[model samples]
Target: MGIHIIKMPDIGEGIAEVELVEWHVQPGDTVVEDQVLADVMTDKATVQVPSPVDGKVQALGGKVGEVMAVGSELIRLEVDGPGNAAAGAKQKRPVERTETAAQAEDATAPAPVQERGADAHVATPGPAQVPIKGQAGQVQPAQSQPQVQPAAGAGHAAARPAGEKPLASPAVRKRAWDLGIELQYVPGTGGGGQITHNDLDSYLARGAMGSAAAGRAAGYAPRDDEQAVSVIGLRRKIAEKMQESKRRIPHFTYVEEVDVTELDALRARLNAQWGAERGKLTILPLLARAMVLALRDFPQINARYDDEAGVVTRYGAVHLGIAAQTESGLMVPVLRHAETLDLWACAAEIARLADAARAGRAAREELSGSTITLTSLGALGGVVSTPVINHPEVAIVGVNRMVERPVILGGAVVARKMMNLSSSFDHRVVDGMHAAEFIQTIRGYLECPAMLFVE
Candidate 1:
């Protein structure tokens, strides 16, 4: 067998490094050509690394969450015939130390001494050691182990005398304490009468600890489990972007209530009429049209701000950003040339871009270069929100949920479908008065739905 090495490829945009997000294959896993071996993150997008040649994975260069530089070794594989790597070259990969592996031997050790009827037997605790896999793929015990006390349920002793401390590892003790379990009264089943994790589980499972335990058996068990998820990939990118936006820009938010009763009615009528010939329309397309028309009077809102250069660019063409929530995280996909598209066309493009973003299939160009962003939580949109401006963009308009509420219209209590527009702007570029005027303009078009089609 020959050795093959796969190095991290440079994922364009002059990026010097990428964070290792996920691994599709591990050592001993057989991978076929064109199969994705790993996923690495560059900025916000995830790029998959596919295997070029069919081979068995020998070793991984780095663990997940490790930021690897370009051209660094990613994975090592063994294939037939002479591979690209030298036959006798030593592969240098970081060894991973897992919590389970550190406690593996302790979990497997023999139980402690016990008294049987009239006779008593003494069981000695073995030396603490951890097993580590050697380069030769052999298991070797490492010397000078970290100090470890026996875990819970250590001994098979039927009963221990009162005031005698129960033998359990620190982890087990902490877990028991969290569960309000008194270890002294509990029996140990581990080596030398030590308490183990299993003993605690079995104890809880059997409902041995009276009323509170019985309540747990009846479905009120208190849990102390925690998961440590590393912030990487798209989530990391979002955090950084949000932090930068908040830190670098002075932000001001404006909110206005709009009577969208006519707008909703118009939408329903359009769907009813075009139900068979064209796709159904959502409230988004109308809003997009309104914003597009409104930008004519308020050019400052449809622009990008270069804070470092002290330049506020005003765009004649409306490039709208549709904020979408994906399985990975929040992503904003750009809807280019919004000024040119009508309501139906805008709806189609919005749906397409949202689908592409959610599926992680959106191209880089489709994700960037938005002049202004429109975000909505749809049915979940609450009464009010303080949206943050998309970095370098002067404004972001947020759509909130619409609800029917009683309103006094010409001395009559009329039920009106009212919605709120929550928008944010970079205070450094767009003034607060202009931001308010911008939202009011959209409101006028929305309340008077026919004006959306006005030339």
Candidate 2:
């Protein structure tokens, strides 16, 4: 038999490392080519790694939640000689023969019996230790050390009742110990009642909450209960981007209230007419149209600032980013060339992009290369907001909730549909007065819907 080393494969664009989420096989298990070995998660997506050759598993790459770098040895397998003949051929023939002879000679030599250590047991090679078990009973490598039964009154044993150790990998046990958490009390979610990292985290979080509650009941100032969530994957990417934007770009915020009474009437009429033929129209498409029209007049807002190059490149086409919240987190899916699409087309494209983003099927191109961004919370949107500018882009427009408010129109009290437009600009690139004027332009188109259609 010859050994085969499987290295981690590149899963996606610019992915350097991935978190090992689950393993499907363990050492000594027979596997066929294309058999799934593990599921790994990157910032962009989750992918399964499959075995490349039929072989007997020898060892795994790492434990769950561990990050494995691309091109690193992921799995070691023992295969038939013929399957790995090319790899074996690289070894010097003489050296291989010599090593084989030495091993044979040692095997034939008398077995030297040695004294066992005070705490040692008979040593024998066994199936690899399962670090953790999944719902299907599949095991992962736990630790290199062999399992040893603890003696009565020994270290760690004296503190607890004697029994089989908790169903957990060595890594999980170590983490629990470090956090001073009792394993027995932590509920396990893995197969055969195995404790996972998530279980331990949940237990600790609950304990913190309990402690805080008890303190409060005793009339004492309760300690703050803080849950530490790992800033990784998509969340990590968002954090880095937001930090970079705030650090590099000086932001200037502008807020304006637009009396959208006339625009709302126009939108209702259009949706009534085209709602059956095309997709239903929302305020977003109309707002996007207004923004596009406004961009035509003030092209500075539709530009990217290259801080390093010390120049701004403006685009005639608007690659609009619409921020949508998904189950995972916030995602901004771009609607490329928004200026070319009319209101109904804009609505259709917006629906398509939002669906793709929420379903986690958005392409990398669709998720990036936005010249400007528009954010709205619909009913949740308050009267006004100070939105953060999408990095590299000069501005972001926020749409607030539309509400009926009493206003003086031509010296008469009338109820009007009013909404606030909150916008933020890169102060370094745009002056405060210029930023206000850009918002004013957008407001004019929205208030006078016909202006949006005018060439």
- Candidate 2 structure quality by residue, lDDT tens digits, 239-264: 77889989999997898999999998
Candidate topping lDDT:
1
Give the residue spans of candidate 2 off by over 4 A.
1-6, 11-69, 74-226
TM-score of each: 0.78, 0.65
Off by over 4 Å in 1: 90-92, 95-222
User: Please, what is the whole-model Cα lDDT of each candidate in the order they appear?
Assistant: 0.78, 0.72
> Can you write out model 1's per-residue Cα lDDT over 53-118, one digit (the tens) per residue?
999988888877678999999998899989999967877664343433446545324222222221
TM-score of the candidate numbered 2?
A: 0.65
* TM-score winner: 1
